[model samples]
Target: MKKKFKILIADRNPHVREFLRREMAGPGYRVRLAENGREVLKFIYGDEFVDLLILDPDLPDTDAPALLRKLQNRLPYIPVVLHTFIADLGHCPDIFNVVAVVEKGGSSVERLKTVVYEILAKDRAKEKIRNNMQSAGQKKAAPATGGKDEQK
Candidate 1:
């Protein structure tokens, strides 16, 4: 069965969060909403199965960059996509924890979906490769660890 990935939308604006929730949620994706950076961290730091995070560059509480950085440091496995209307700060938030930075209001919601999928798709690809490698390593070690016992 195909794995369903959990995605988090963290935006201060209710309308924006709702828009993103509607766009990103559907079959094969478990969507969660967070109103601010603190909430986002709260949801993430726990045992949530979130794999992708979409962050608002302009948040209400703490600075977005710092929040993103802390997220990235704590959970490097999850890919973060930053959204904003500001062109200057739109530069890649790679310094913090953002994997991709996208500009808002340039295109329609459909376009944002496309951009978001593109970024997350890249991350999923990398994750697949990592998983495959780990699987191979486990296979190689299985004989060494249990082969003698099984033979006996």
Candidate 2:
């Protein structure tokens, strides 16, 4: 069986949070909300687990890049998608560590959905590989330890 793909939407606006949660929930992703930078870190450190983060750069407590650095401790393996209205002539870098930086506008929903789907797909594939490796290791060790009862 597969576990649900968890998504954390970290933004201060109530309407945005609710809307994002609703949109993300449509595709079997377990969506969570964080009202500010502090709350986002709290949820990241918690055991609830998050596979992808959709971060608004101009958050209430902190800016996007700083929050991304802070969140690295708890979700180092997870990919972040920067969601903001900071699109400008040269605001975007040629390459970024973030999987995607989406511009917030009328068509933002479709853009976000695309990035979310890509991130989830990659995360699931990595998780499956890890699980398979663990399974293979257990199987190999089971016989070396003289069967289940002895190993247990």
Candidate 3:
């Protein structure tokens, strides 16, 4: 069976967190919510693996830029979708892990969902290719079993 992708949604607004959770959970993703920067850090650094993050740079009680930098350093493999207001986009730190910046609006959830799906699909494709390459390399590295040297 395929593993369900786990997503962490971090926003300062309780309503936004819950709304995103409901939206993402409907499609069978394991959704986790964080209402502040501390909670976001806890979830990301915890034992549970997260496949993606939907982050609002205005998260309370922490420096947003610092958090973004830290996440980029520690979890570069996990893609982050910045869910923030359009005006605040300029203040956001440019980080490698941020795959998309989604403006928050009444109709933005659909776009967020589409972005998440595309990112995960791309990741899956890359993983498949890596696995295939590894298998091929292993087959090539294996010694021939029925050669003249084996008979001797």
* Total clashes in model 2, counting residue pairs 3 or more apart in sequence or in different chains: 0
Q: Model 1: per-residue lDDT, tens digit, 70-104?
A: 77678877777767765647443445556666677
Higher-scoring candidate on TM-score, 1 or 2: 2
* Candidates 1 and 2 compared by lDDT, better number: 2
lDDT of 2 by residue, 1-152 (tens): 66788889987788998999988896467998988888887876777878888877666765555666666655677788878776631433432347888888998988899889988888789889999999999898874546667733
User: Higher-TM-score candidate among 2 and 3?
Assistant: 3
Deviating ranges (above 4 Å) for candidate 1 = 87-94, 106-108, 134-152
Against the true structure, what is every candidate's RMSD? Answer: 3.8, 4.3, 1.8
Clashing pairs in 1: none
Q: Candidate 1 local accuracy as lDDT?
A: 0.75
> Which segments of candidate 2 are over 4 A away from where they belong?
88-97, 144-152
lDDT of each: 0.75, 0.77, 0.86
Scored against the true structure, residue 4 in model 1 reaches a CA lDDT of 76
Q: What is the lDDT of residue 115 in candidate 3?
A: 99
